[model samples]
Target: MTRSEPDVRAEQEALFSTGAEHYARHRPGLPAVLFEALPAGYGRPLTAIEEARLVIDAALDAVSGIAYGVAHNDPELAERGRRTLARLRAERRAPLSPTGDAT
Candidate 1:
């Protein structure tokens, strides 16, 4: 059965709360290949794997920034968090171009 939005979010929050410390400590650094493969913009439809990777990267970036901001008391990290989150939201809302491209 499908889970409701609140259920999904609650589960995710529980998972993060339990693992945030370990995640902060042991999270692998982003591979250069991942960055290299990113398009300059969403000008074409991404493959399923590419889309998943992008989502994960954006989530991680935002979360990591928040953690860093808390640890270091740096406001710039919060700005980065905001930008990354906005990018993710835009990606979700963006419609395909006339040619069925992502842009």
Candidate 2:
């Protein structure tokens, strides 16, 4: 079943709030200079993972928009969402170069 927009938004807001609260409660008090001293590779994998996650999130958001548009009888919004999904799918199928750009 498609979820209502408000329901989905509330869930996202709650999740973000929880994450913020956790960080606030447990994050270290280390100075910025200490973080800067760490090796470059220390956070490279994390950065890559986060970048991948953002791409996935964009796809999911398009899907959610399609669902919401359909539920609300907004054909224009639904079509736009469909186009976004199609473009994303094409990008996914394209051959990637060594540097990760589609070629």
Candidate 3:
């Protein structure tokens, strides 16, 4: 932020780290319908297993334990979130069922 700029500049730009797994961990889970209802640009929907794998990867990535009580908090979960997002993209075009449903 430039010193001359007003304080209400919305911090220049809102941040969106690709690995924000806070939603996957601290936050309550999202609904199945929400994933199925992903916007048209999500590429394709995924099967139950594919979705589960994505979530599992995110959960694992959020673990940032330390030998003592002095560790960086929030689990540094970006990598896992990235993997999950990638999986979601890959699964978008895959048939979700034998009937050829993508979700």
TM-scores of the candidates in the order shown: 0.43, 0.42, 0.27
Worst 10 residues of 3 by lDDT: 8-17
- Whole-model lDDT per candidate: 0.52, 0.50, 0.38
Clashing pairs in 1: none
Question: For model 3, how does the per-residue alpha-carbon lDDT over 1-103 read when each residue is reduced to its tens digit?
Answer: 2234532121211111122233545455654343333322245554455544444443343332221213434334444444545654565544456553545
Instruction: Give the per-residue lDDT of model 2 (tens digit) for 1-103.
Output: 1254532333333233333433444575634453333223233432333344444665676677689989999885576567667766776744445665546
CA deviation > 4 Å runs, candidate 1: 1-46, 93-103
Model 1 lDDT tens row, 2-101? 2445323323332333234334445656443433332423355555444444466557757888789878998766666765677567768445465545
Regions more than 4 Å wrong, model 3? 1-42, 65-103
The full ranking of all candidates by TM-score, starting with the best, is 1, 2, 3
Alpha carbon lDDT at 54, candidate 2 = 40
Q: What is the lDDT of residue 78 in candidate 3?
A: 43
- Candidate 1 vs candidate 3: the lDDT winner is 1
